[model samples]
Target: MVSDTEILAFFRGELSRQVNRKLQTVPLELETLLQDYAPADELPYVISDYSNKYGVDVSALDMRNYFPWENLPLTTRLFKGRNFRASVIANRKPLTVKMFAESARAGRWLYD
Candidate 1:
């Protein structure tokens, strides 16, 4: 079984790579939301890389359930309006480093 420390280290390295920043120390806490570290556009790629590297099955994971869309198209912005967009952001469940670590250890996505 992978220890939590190893899992966290993997995330630290992966996140640092995604953000193009070299971290000398733990830059992320277990509860830290991953969206805060990397761009939403890059988040899926990061997760995909992690899933592949750790053999974690993420087929059931939905990106929309965790992070809000980064950029809505012009038509979407106009039709959805600011309130609709705000609600989507407000209702998104946080995808934290701890969750990723847990999933990695479990070899599958654990959150709904």
Candidate 2:
């Protein structure tokens, strides 16, 4: 499986020709070898903010039953998988797991 960085670099390379004519754009470099990783679907649970905040101890989520917050405990439903839709996460607002957990606990931001 290709690493996310590799995918990003490929995308940049694909766009280089359509970008500014004079400006040179070197693609970002990735040092880690992705061969060790398994296929996306076959991979382990994805320990994203959702997992960290709720203390859900799973790695590499299954894309099939990929309902992020669907079956969580009622009290946690509001917060489970909440991080994915946060403006901070969606808009790339520089949030950490701890901060995200705090925000979720506060029930301040929610997406419809």
RMSD of each: 4.0, 15.2
lDDT of 2 by residue, 1-112 (tens): 3334433443233322222357664332333211112223322232343444445333332322333333346766555455643432333222122332333444432221
Off by over 4 Å in 1: 17-26, 71-73, 78-81
> Lowest-scoring 10 consecutive residues by lDDT in candidate 1?
17-26
Report how far off residue 61 is in candidate 2 (Å): 19
Best by lDDT: 1
lDDT values for all models: 0.77, 0.34
In model 1, the Cα lDDT at residue 83 comes to 89
How accurate locally is residue 27 in candidate 1, as Cα lDDT from 0 to 100? 59
Q: Write the per-residue lDDT of candidate 1 for residues 24-104, one digit (tens) a residue.
A: 453577787776666677777778888888899999888877765555577787788888888978888898888887888
